[model samples]
Target: SGMLITGVTTLLLSLLVLALAWWASIRGAQMRSSLPPGPTPLGLLGNLLQLEFGGLDRALMKVAQTLSRNWGPIFTVWLGPRPAVVLCGYAALRDALVLQADTFSGRGAMPVFQRFTRGNGIVFSNGPRWRTLRNFALGTLKEFGMGTRSIEEHIMEEAACLLGEFQATNGTPLDPQRLLDNAVSNVICSAVFGKRYGYEDPEFLRLLELFNDNFRIMSSRWGEVYNIFPSLLDWLPGPHHQIFQNFEELRTFISEQIQQHQETRKFGEPHDFIDCFLDQMDKVLAPQDPESHFQEETLVMTTHNLFFGGTETTSTTLLCLTDSCPAQVQAELDAVVGRARAPCLEDRVRLPYTNAVLHEIQRFISVLPLGLPRALTRDTHLRSHFLPKGTMVIPLLVSAHRDPTQFKDPDCFNPTNFLDERGEFQSNEAFMPFAPGKRMCLGAGLARSEIFLFLTAILQKFHLLPVESPSNIDLTPQCTGLGNVPPAFQLRLMAR
Candidate 1:
């Protein structure tokens, strides 16, 4: 019994000693690493308490704003023990992404991402794989009629079906979100898989709900902690487990689709994303040097990337776009675009109120609030501050969108920011919801087309009726899974 007690005591002491050594090692290196000044970290805890107040992005915005006002464009913060520089304002963001693109070449990978995606997808991979996959996906999108009439026609057909679904709601208060999600998801799914499901499709509905639930749970302190102490979470039980499981469920669905495609192999001439992937596989797999990552694994992850990244972002932005706009935007759409035309991408030029409203929603909503964390590829200087290689740099995208210096009324949901006196859509360089530079969203063009077409379609066919007084619909967004999801609200779709 005495020996047993001694062994337990020794084990505890050893763990404590190792932890101290590990922590000391981290602090000494981080302290020496050349970066701009930041708030002092509290040992292992870092400045987590400060950044995690309400939300990580919100707290980062507050920190970035305060420092940029005093510290200028470039400033640093400690996310746990890791030192992260906050690149605030549009000018600095543009410079880093556009001018100093090579310095910020790598997208920082998080522990949560590693757990969920297994480094198999385009969203996080770096170097040759990332470049190849991104190019391939972009090419695939083009082949599938991303900008052409072929793809636009598919979106138009889906939009028509979506309008019909909304009309069936019979003026009763219906959640515009689900109908909108159905429409948007169908667009991407059709583009990726070469088929679209009905609004009532159970399998498709489950996929939407999985992503929705994952998004909900991912935006909390849980996600922040996952980003930092991912190794520690493996020892303890938590929500991230379920989140990973949900992601796996999604991956499983994607894998099955790939299998179905494989059985009937016509990949050399891809009609959609999956077919394009197969074509890439055949081209890359040479007889002499046959080392290829472009296979079933890549195909599955690519589809997942397209569906997961493409769908929620497009849908959430649409939801926010509607929420931010006044009823008058819809009324104006009805007056100008009218029901007979079937709102098209080209119509945004004539639909001043609608275009302004879309831009405002993107700016205000800020889908990627903290922006994706980027890793410094090499030692670099930004605004006279030295950033060390491998340091996680949080691009203050949310802050930039609403920066007081950049926008006229930064806090308000004013669509006029994007409109001239003539009410024609005039864009500002500062307004970058899809982010900027080399790592900018690959689907930016497709998303723009989708948003323009979807909104135009709905507005043309039906008027956005608010539940009760429309005043009850919340503007406060639900921060989840690295995004700001729209609040729970319903819209009654009155047929035009």
Candidate 2:
């Protein structure tokens, strides 16, 4: 009789706890009825089971289409129990990201980046840290020739070197990935490290290859899974582990650079961003302020952030642009600039077709479909949803790029999208390849300059021919999620 009484009492306590939890859930849901509408989610798992099969970009689009029909332009989706409010279509994204900028300026937690950076760098930090780093970086970069003619000289020099490499190929088919990587990486290396590496330098090649491998995996399905369910996937062994390894290797490389700068850097006369940062560190470290973000680890991560951002996306876009419509680009180059001198930024206005083609390429690719997730800094009302502080927000960039209201034939790749009926370059408010508002890509100016200079220089010297027939060439990306990575193909740089 004593044993039966004890068991009955324990069971009653358990039942009481479950009843309380159920009551709390119901109460919370009732309180948040004004929150954006979404499909009812299973506990803890949320919508992961529904999103497992297709690319996250496509799946999200489908969800947006289905939910927006009932919930309107802005709706909620539970990414593993955490509710993320997505801004679909052009108007919704522009309103949240541009109009209410400060409230939505907080950077969301990107698991892959957070694991590596630990909230240190400009790319993935929030609040005061983000403002400090971003301002310092912009000011320092401007001093070092970002968005200036001084920077164009650096890019043109790299372009000349790249031209030599292509000339060396002797009309044979070559994989342009490594060559393009070397050229683009050199431009950023000049700004960050105060020097550029030789194309054949083993150490530089290894670092570039590491970045490439990480980018490939990061865009793969495994990378998407890691982003959505980091805690669950952390223990499970997979290619995601390689991403961590690559990050460590990159960290080591950056550490070596910082150590060398610390030992050799001269005061009052800084050469690059690292030197400027060291100068700032000297001033700030004297006070030993607890809130100061000038630590050595921050330096390493920021350098990696700049280098990684500067290299991959620009090079990948060049490859895709050249592969997609080489003949037309070359024809424009021949007509306008001729094959006499390397193309410069000043000529960008003169060559309307070339400018339009580059713009079209950026629009067509939509490299970062889901712009970096943002967070609410405070409790805010956005598009009828009463969102709590720290709610994750996604600005669906692809929706803007593909909005029918903004461009004619949004799905098709046509240079005319960026051209007027008179055949001059035209700008579109919805053509936000670099995104818009305060959080727009800092390197946008540099990237546009690089793409223009390098492609025109190459076109001036040689014709970019594909290994396969033009009819057989496909422009679909190999992976599509956070970023759309263009498919790899060899090109014959036949001398013109």
**What shift in Å separates residue 84 of candidate 1 from its native position after superposition?**
1.5
Worst 10 residues of 1 by lDDT: 317-326
lDDT of 2 by residue, 1-496 (tens): 9999999999998888677556645643663475688777555556677775326777778787766779887887767656678888889888888888888888898898899999888888888998999999999999889522399999999999999999999989988978998999998888888888999999999999888888788888888778878987999999989999999999999999999999998987788889999999888886558678888899999998888787877887776655557787778878888877778899999988888888878888888888888988989887667888888888888888888888889888888888899998998888876778777887888888998998889878887788998777787888887688778778999888
Superposed Cα RMSD, model 1: 2.6
Query: Per-residue lDDT tens digits of candidate 1, residues 1-496?
Result: 9999999999999999679757855774656457777666665666777765437777766776666566777777776666677787788898887788877868887787777667777878777788888887777687668522477798889888987887778899876778778888888887887788888989999988987777776776676677788888877788867788898898899888877777886756555677777777777788765657686777777677777677767777655544565477777777877766777766777878778888888888888787788887888877777777787887888777887777879888888888889878888888877777778887788788888888777766666767756565576776643877777777777776
- lDDT value for candidate 2? 0.83
Flag regions of model 2 displaced more than 4 Å.
Answer: 1-34, 52-54, 146-149
Of the candidates shown, which would achieve the greatest TM-score relative to the real structure? 1
Q: All models: lDDT?
A: 0.76, 0.83
Return the TM-score for each candidate structure: 0.93, 0.92
TM-score of 2: 0.92
Q: Model 1: runs farther than 4 Å from truth? A: 1-22, 25-33, 146-149, 320-327
